[model samples]
Target chain A: MRPLGDDTGPAIEVRGLRKLYGQTVALHDIDFEVSKGEIFAVLGPNGAGKTTTVEILEGFRPREGGTVKVLGEDPFRADEEWRARIGVVLQTTGEFEDLNVREVVRHFARYYPDAQDPDELIERVGLAEKRNARASKLSGGQQRRLDVALGIIGRPEVLFLDEPTTGFDPSSRRDFWQLIRDLATSGTTIVLTTHYLEEAEQLADRVAVIVGGRILDIGVPQTLGGRDTEATVVSWMGPDGLESVHTTAPTKFAADLHARLGGEAPGLTVHRPSLEDVYLQMIGADTAATAALASAAGVTTEDS
Target chain B: MTVLTVAPARRLPRARLRRIASLGLYRGQLELLQFFRGTETVVFSLLFPVFALVIFSSMFDGEIAPGVTYSDYLVPGIIATGLMVTGFQTLAISIAIERDRGGLKRIAATPMPRSAYFIGKVIMVLVTSVVETVVLVAVSVVLYGTHLPGTADAWLTFGWVSLLGVTACALCGIALSSLPRNSRSAPAVVAPFAFVLQFISGAALVFTDLPPWLQWIASAFPLKWMCQGLRSVFLPDSYAAQEAAHSWQLGWVAVALIAWVILGTVLCLATFRWTKTRDGG
Candidate 1:
């Protein structure tokens, strides 16, 4: 559709974005980009301009001021043909009260020139049997799958999913992730905004944490929140019974302990700062002392 | 991947019509199905005009405007009322619901032209209006021996009234739809003022004997002119003997109807919301 507006362009690019709701500013100079064929996650708490930025990108909300290029075209002024090349799964969509799952998918399929077969999409979303079930009757997770099915039905080059698995249970969330992974493997650029940190860790190739209308940092989950360079807390059984040490190099500590004991270190174990720990630190939390140290060292942050 | 080529159905126009017609038919079926399933909307829409028809005709039977039978005068008025209730009132509720359910939002996100959604809704209302008119006419003929207008002029009047009535109502509906906070609040906002308008200016109240102030209010509204036009079709020439401006006052009737349609259309285009605006800030 419209030649993808220059193949060399990033999947999306936003610069100097600003939005105001009356006297309150919803977004302030927010900027981000998604390279081709990568899963980019926008992480934020509620009221963090996540929805506003995504809505503006989807052309559902007007921008107060910004330059947004989606597939190298200004999304706000893009025509239907441009819309055909991108897919958006909003927070929620209209529930087709009477139509079965298949019918609803089939109906939306007509709006696009190149649409995926509804039956196949239904199966892909793990709702093959429930395809004939009315949308209103489907369980929450199943209904969410239908939302995903509709999003992908256009066979879009870029997909924007807003908390796609927010209400999903553990098993359903996993299944939904696999579906997304499948799409990404086939070269679909995915932009996701979610509240779940673990979800970002599992799905996003690069995650950006946004707060108070600006991005705090962007990196791989392990390296984000200054996770990679942080010291690990090592614990083991000493001659006295038990011992533990917080060290920058757990491997070297274990090696020294082995020489002291003349054998393997007893009950050898190590605890390192998790991605969540580093996240809490960047957003400013008291318990992230290790994360603070990582930040101060300048070794923790990894720019992606 | 296995490649399977399917032949395009390029031979028959009838087959093409059938395929295309099915989409519209499905949408229409969905509309009617939703209408009937909602007990509150159906009861209010169907019963309000019927109650008006029964009460007014009974109260003024054989004495309305001299020679005109109350039932004869009331039937046309009720049909006009039905058009308003079904189109205008229904439009307000439907648009509010669409906003609340994110239907408008969803449609806005799609490649489908935004106008198509409104057009489809108006078409649904038009179909329902036609059916309501037929039902009212049937009941009038069966229960009260009310005659369908005999000549081509009478049919012409019906056509114009139906078209103008629906157009005005739909436009007004779209305009007023933006007033409600959500679907639950829709009735609280729309029903009160709507009933107030009908109560003051509506023809169902036997306006021939009403106070001067009430008559002035009725005269100020387009529904008054619409009802007056409908009455001209059914009531005999002697019925006009009591009208303040006797001989139908066709000029005022035409002007009021045109004014409402134009004003209503402009308002709808200007203010109708396709998506919800967060009210917190």
Candidate 2:
């Protein structure tokens, strides 16, 4: 929580990071930067090296080759003082055995130089009602909430959340997103990895898609893979029954359709590509085929 | 978005040690709570030694040697076995399970010093060992009429020997836990080995008439010395005649237990891991 003299500096910087398990490479030449106060999300399929990257950043795993700096210090060589400034929520929830939610959170709080009050953190993570419940007795989603509470209780300058909302219910996921936003607004740099595209799209200021041990692309979620400028889809019920067209200019196409119909076009809709569409395309997949499948199901790609 | 004022990070060097100690104590307390909550763990740690003492003593009413009831002689040995169970078996099995379950890995990710965790485990094991020993001794003295150590010298010997034995066994347990592939396999590997040592060391039965080679093998392990040292405190001085060396050999017992303590410490440092897949790092 220290006031960084130059607030403009990136909170995390990784360059040419490489890792290998025997002959199989886990990460190959990965590079990314997360600016201070940004919510950065890393999206990848299973075995795509997302966890490897986050683990390296959290100082949990040693990288074979890379120059990685978190909070302007090499995480691999960072001391306890350096560690005190960073918080990590691992994919696996830490089992507290007999300790209750509040006890687990409060026990972890002492490890930090500047920690949030445990009671406030439990409430912030929406676990106040379950604060006295034994950690193992809580449901999976509640345990994940406890994981997040422990992560942020450190009052870290940077927080690493590895699939933080994996088991959260829809409403709790939304609540978690709001909590993350609140943290980012308070200038806490958050780097999260998640398989949920909607989560990345909703939470990340900038997102990176990684596949096959490498980064496929990194950009603002809306603009990745030129999603913002991708040809929009125009759909309507026409004379033939239903018709849809993908065009660079949806407004002109819709107007032409309305003029041709001589009045209000039934079911007229304009839709740009969604984050999932751009993500699938960036990962070297055929989104057009998925669009066809949606069309066959009477669901327009625009509706998706 | 409301811009909240971030508090300046303050380093309280003065409170750091206090914080670490408190956290370590908290962790120890949690471990003890979990241990007592599990009925199986409580039964195994607290009652197993007492049960063994009763069954063995009732089965063998005769003396193992002159002037020493088999029941009285077995009291100290059972106390030694209690130490091994609490310090060795319990520690190894729990650590393996915790590692398999990602508990240790999660603690590694936190800013808590790794030493604090080991310290906490040591504290938990030590307290459990004390409880086990006290219960076993109290039961033996009351029910079996086993003689308690009388002199200050006997008490001092009992204190140091039990302390060193528990420390050595606990460290060895932690080191050996790293060898098991998972928690399920941990007891499979450690229990048989512990049982073999207890059997040969006369903790469960008298192995005095065994081959010299077998006696030497048992002596190489700390449990034998632990049992012998405890017997020196509780049993009459004349009971030394029944021992392998025809004397208490307290000096050799001290040397062997101390050596294990040193070796176990080194092995634990070299082999211990926060997770099963992760190495020493």
Candidate 3:
């Protein structure tokens, strides 16, 4: 991966972003920053304010109270010039009924000052064969590919994708991931939200777990919630039967087990928490209890 | 596959007037293409006026007033009704459907100006209205023996009245579309209003003996002025004897239509929404 340019400022920045629907608070006190050229993932359950945050960043919704800066400008007041620099792939694909793939992309291209060739974009999204097919005739995944093609045709500096791979089969999901990776490699900042922890782990340089309209934790995916540095589960056959214990020092425990057995420990195995495990723990219990536990365990829960 | 170079991001200048005009033209062309390709829209917009003419003309054989046969009087009224159906009803329902389906929201999220989108939509509706009018007039002339105005003065009156009437109806349609909660409810809300207006405006039957109160109510809307102005163009000067003012009242027609255009423009701008409220974050 190419190093993020240090001289350039963050691609996105938000502080105290708040949204309200009547009396209900949708997003409360949200804060985060996406570095230039980095893949940032926002992982949350449904109704967790993920879409609200993304929409606010995309300038599709108004913010009740917050300071938001995308590409060093306030998105709420930004004009078309600022909009031209950002691409958004909404959760629901827009209906372009009667328009074929090439025609739809070509039509959207006219809105931008400088847009990629429609034919080239079609090939980039692997829709070359379906270019002549009407939008309504394409399958769900194929329609999503067309959405991505339209999203990137303007060569956006920051691309916001909301649950981009929700309905895709595994193979198509993988192919879509590769397309995103290529865009990231070419220095586009990506901010994505997904219900898939594996997707966040596989794609994001850093991930933030948001629940109940609040950011619970943010860090590198592997070490989020101290999953990488926390205790490991060691399991083996004991004197009577199988035994398992959570320990901070797994290697020492295994060596001691070997010495006691006078040989190789039977069925010996060690496992660390996966990203999903860390994510679940961060968002699972009462917020106060989770915070107390993190403090007790000396795990740093500050945003990275 | 060929490797394409992805350009770096740069700050583009604001859209210039020339670019907006060209883009609006392109969007209009695409809209027209989609409209023509849809079988339902084409048949409803084109054939409905012709059908109305045939059915209404066949039912009335006597002269409506001295020197004005029922067919002659009904031709201009039917043309006015056709304009309302195509300009007002069709535009409103289509915009509602687009909003419900996320198409309008998607375009709004782009860099395109709202004015440009509105312009494109207006142009599409205007073009469709023009086509419907020509076909309906042709059918009236050939089969019903309806005579068009030969003098340039009458033609000029027809030109401005039609232009203003169509613009006002199209704008009102867009404004009224926002009252419906969803696309399904849009037709229910707009169709009844259109039907009542057509009835009161004398599109369905000549209303020479219409109640004064009802006539005042009908004159409040653009459809009434549209029908009256069209009648002035197609009916002989002597036929004006049957009118309420004993004349065509061309001046009042222009005033009422222009006032509607202004009022409708304001209402449309105030109520037009690209996305449904429930869909917003």
Candidate 4:
């Protein structure tokens, strides 16, 4: 890896990025910036333009309109030098026949001017045991591990991973998350899209929700859509049975409950909406808004 | 909680064709490795032509001319058949699978030079063609008692015919790869086309017996001329009476082959894709 110069700028920048297939827009007005070392997660449901957005940035797909810059270079007009700086793990792709884990990694390693040791990379991605196993022989999760190893082999400054850990078991997912963090800790800017909300909450420093070809919200996980500040649900085992209240003042509400019986409030518990909760809420709200706009414009939806 | 810095992007060194050639040569080694590793596919694809030659030569057993055995006439055409199978059939399947199967698109994202890949494919075709040639010719001379070409002129003709034939067929294979909707359907398109071409083009040793329309169809493709060119190398000049033109026509064969190579190049440029979908870029 080369030394980073003293330039203060985001690793990735997108302004008014738009994509279209015929008259239907796949993505529009898409914009965001990812600082170096930040783990930025793009969260969305299926067909929400997540893949389109990432593909445009990865230079695999052309955009209709936008100013997109990755590492101070236009990715759409990307050159070899620009390619050397970025890594991509696209949503599950076909692996090569006859190439074992180590060989494929080493093969990709040669494409870069500076690449991590193939053996060390295999170990890093936790495919050490399967180093000699041919690609066809590996299980799905193992194959994904190989994909991750190949993605980071060049020691890319910015890595784009689209559902990279889809097939992993729980333990492997955790290990993979830790490996992602290790990469970020060393100053690699990471952008990942995944169906797993907990993955975003656990790994992302900041997250964005994209829905219907546009951004629904963007914020740190704790405060995304005010998840941290959303009304908390307070519950306790009351005289009749379990009772509950949704309140912004959970602490005060709990105290009031505590004093009401002049004793312990049995089975008292408090919790707020989680990341998944807020994310689904945002998707739901977006759907309603789009439907309302369509109805007002007298455009009949498919279901309608 | 902390700021981060990353390695700065740098420009590539100047375009050096020598460096590109060496890089391509290295990638070619991996291509060879992958090919040989698929033991069943390699063995079956290369051996089918040799076996076909033996069966047809034995069944058509007799001297077609004064002391000119059928094996003598059959060996060269079979060698051409070997080249077609290795260069056209195998390459089309492999490249289609490699593309739709995800390897090409993955490679596309890297800093690997675009030319290196085609160069690697060329090298792979050359290496495999060599194996097919050695095996087919050895079987012809040692097992069937076929005579070797007696002159350097014959050997020179052999070299150019084999080279041009493989180049043309291999490029056609690549151009045709994107025609398959996906890797799974590659053989569905390639196999029938290759087999049909060989029969009509004289690999079955029946080009003269085919209907005029069929012969004309064979003449339109590179395989017929390739087979005709190879036949000129092994059979005596007097045996040219058996050919449709009653002349060697080696020059026309070369011209036809070079034309196919040019056409194949154009088709490859127009139709090739890194992936199966229209979204492929």
Candidate 5:
């Protein structure tokens, strides 16, 4: 097959994507794009449709309505070449129980035309310590790490990770994050779905907030829900006691406090809204908005 | 990406086809490795038929025909059972479990040709069934004076019959794997299904000794034909008189097995599912 799209276009594109699990609408008109080499994160709570969206993009699930293109080809109709360009790391999997970590990695490497060196990939994912450990013998965290190694062994052009690092320790998560960053720098597009908002802030170039089967917002982590310009909570020790103020400009507030003290302000701290704060606030707002609509409809009562 | 001069929508180039074939070979090799390494399954599948043969040979120590001993009859029956156990029961249960584990879905995500998985599974089935057959044959030959096919023609018959039996049973496994609701229920569903078939198909019970209704029912299935085909090779020509037909219907046996192979292929292609996601997304 000839190349699908120009290298400059977005690596993944979705528009008006809709999915239903029987009668229940699982995803409603979801929309987004992951540009080439960009690390895009999807943030949502459990059952908030993050996995559904990611699965659809990964060609693991079918959408009832909408168009999706990963690497400029519809994933549902993608050929082997199209498939060779993408990789997926699901939440958890049980496979190769009899095979060791090294064997499993090497097994997956055979699927692609151009694959990463299995040993180097295992090392990159920090499975070197347990390279010979049987899959069934691995701890929960180690199993998840092996899954990550398998996902990247194909050297895919685009990778999909759904709640990766769930079972990882702090250091492992850090190492995994570094590995992701390295992959992105080498022009691998990544779409990550995570419940951990800090992970989104840490690795995602852009983040999408999906709630109740709909996308609430999509922007850079710093500006998601206007986090960059939104009010920052600044606190200081005043003459009376401790004082806190919400201001759009935290630096000016801190400077004013510094001037008032004619020196460094004691216990003075400036804090902007974190990505987690914005995510939770967005989810809370969506909940509140639905509740408001329900109450406006007389608390779900039928009209007489 | 390599630029191509001619554009064909679905036709793969020769080199890619070769690569896919080689990849499937590698996948098959790994599958065999995994199967042999699996201790519990390996031991159970390998010995179940041999045990049945030994028990039956001891229980029925009389002449099946004038020159044919019960061991001669039981060897072929047990070989048929061995093929079914490896090709049908074990394969179905293992595939169900693997699908539940997301292994099939993971493989589906790769650029790996769909044929690679089937090739791998078929190779495992073929090799294990042959091994199961050989172990049962050797045990009968050494311990019970059971004779093997001495002539080249008889040996060729054995080979083709064994190959067809394995192909039909493996396809049955692939098709019926979708019947189980989930992995936990697979063994429960597949084992009893195979168990009842063996009894009715004369692998466990004597085909001619059973009632005409059971005989007719057995005749309709491939397992009975497989046993009949094997019995013709392992037993003396006089033993054909003991068959339900009073003669070895090798022609009808081949037809039934080939028909079942076709049916199983259709069902496998039509019903094989990579994932059974009953939980709402």
Candidate 6:
């Protein structure tokens, strides 16, 4: 991932934002900053206030406390011009089923002063042939592409994508990632919230993980949950069929093996926690530690 | 070949034109698209007043109160009731559906003004009601030999009453839609209440046979006054002689319009939801 620039002002800045639902606390003093022209991903399990935070930023919901500013204006109190600078692609679908793809795009293009031509945007999203087709008739991935087309039509400075590729097939998800990368390259700030670790690893300059309404950690995806710096577990086939070694430094072990043998050790492999594994462990550390004891008794425990 | 070195010229007029067309023609086209796709709504709504007119006219063929033919009295009332059902009731159902499906929330997130959304919908409903009104008028004249308003004044009255009635009902529809939990319950909840208003207050079936309390309640709703005004326009000026007073029904029209304009504004402002998802979730 490219390093996000430090010179640009924060495209989105939030401090101690809170939202309550009667006795239930949906978000408890959440704080984060997204720099301009950077792809910042909010990674979290469901019910962790990701949607709530995004809604508040979009000016659809009022926050209970703290401050939020988008593009130098307080989002909650900002007027339509401020809204024009931001684009949002929500999770819900099939709302504009009656309108054809081109019609829907053209309709939304009216909302902003500086909008791209509807036809060009439709073609860019690879829905040019389906331009005259009703949105409801489009495939799941196509609908998602249309959603992105609608989102970016406004020439928005900041885009909010909430699980944008949730129902997309692999190829479509890759295409969407490339589209996002192109937008980011052209200096559009993007804030993405997704459940897929691969999506975050591939696209995010920085990712923030939230659990139970609080951010557990925020860093580059490869480094998040300390996966990059965490100890590597080296496993190899030995006289006893297989033996494993865990250590902070794997390079020294490799050097020792090179000295012992003429070259690479037989069946030798070194692995650190995968991003998915690291994420699971970070989210369910207590559960994983407790399960380790049960697994020692020759029993496997279910995922948390 | 000579290459001319030229700076990019500003295209302000083209930009402005694009913006205007985007807001107006594009949005208008979308409303038209939704209207065409809604087949079930069209079938049920079209049959409703037509069926009511046919059934009620047949049952009261011999006598419809006094002097006036059953068709004459019934046409105006059915038109008024149809306006209520289509303009107000249908608007409510559409709004509820948009809200439930997250359509309203999506639009709200856009830069489009809330006023634009309302203006587009109201325009769509008014156009539909005008077309339906014309169709009914043509059907009445062809099948039942119904007469059109004689004077310019009568025609003027018809136009004004239709405009005001549609406005009042559409606003009332917006107000009523605010009560439903989701789009699915909208028809189940609105249909029964709407039928009650149509039969009792709309003066559609038996205006004279209804109880005094029911009459008073019906009198308060705009549908009652709208039908009465139409009765005046379609029937001879002497039509009000069957009622308590001659000019009193016209007074009712003015009063109903005022009450609806004021109260309907309050209700719409209070209940309209821009987002279906609850706060914080």
- Which sections of candidate 3 miss by over 4 Å? A1-7, A92-94, A229-244, A256-269, A285-304, B1-15, B209-211, B278-281
Q: Which stretches of candidate 6 lie over 4 Å from their true place?
A: A1-8, A238-246, A253-265, A285-304, B1-26, B244-248
Considering DockQ, which of the candidate structures 2 and 3 is the better prediction for this target? 3
TM-scores, one per candidate: 0.87, 0.91, 0.88, 0.90, 0.89, 0.88
- DockQ for candidate 1, please give it: 0.24
Q: Global lDDT of each model? A: 0.75, 0.82, 0.82, 0.82, 0.82, 0.77
- Chain A superposition TM-score, candidate 6: 0.89
DockQ-based CAPRI category assigned to the predicted complex of candidate 1: acceptable
* Candidate 4 or 1, higher DockQ: 4
- Give the per-residue Cα lDDT of candidate 3 at A1: 16
Point to the candidate with the largest lDDT.
4
Q: Local error of candidate 6 at B29, Å?
A: 4.2
Worst 10 residues of 5 chain B by lDDT: B1-10
> What order do you get sorting by TM-score, best first?
2, 4, 5, 3, 6, 1
Runs off by more than 4 Å, candidate 2: A1-8, A92-94, A284-287, A292-304, B1-19, B276-281
DockQ ranking from best candidate downward: 5, 6, 3, 4, 2, 1
TM-score of chain A of each: 0.88, 0.91, 0.87, 0.91, 0.89, 0.89
**True contacts recovered per prediction:** 0.26, 0.30, 0.36, 0.38, 0.54, 0.55
User: Chain B alone, TM-score of each model?
Assistant: 0.84, 0.92, 0.92, 0.92, 0.94, 0.88
- RMSD per prediction, one decimal? 6.9, 5.4, 6.7, 6.6, 6.4, 7.6
lDDT of 3 by residue, B125-206 (tens): 8899889989988998899777778999988988888889999999999898788888888889889988898878878778
DockQ of each: 0.24, 0.29, 0.31, 0.31, 0.36, 0.32
In candidate 5, the second chain superimposes onto the true chain B with a TM-score of 0.94
- Per-residue accuracy of model 6 over A1-304 as CA lDDT, tens digit each: 1124523568889999888877788888988898899999987777777777887887777777899988876776666666678898876568787778887888788787789999999999889899999888998888889888878989888999988887778787888899999999998999988877788888999989888888889998778888788877777777778876767899998888778877768888887666666676777755444321221111212212
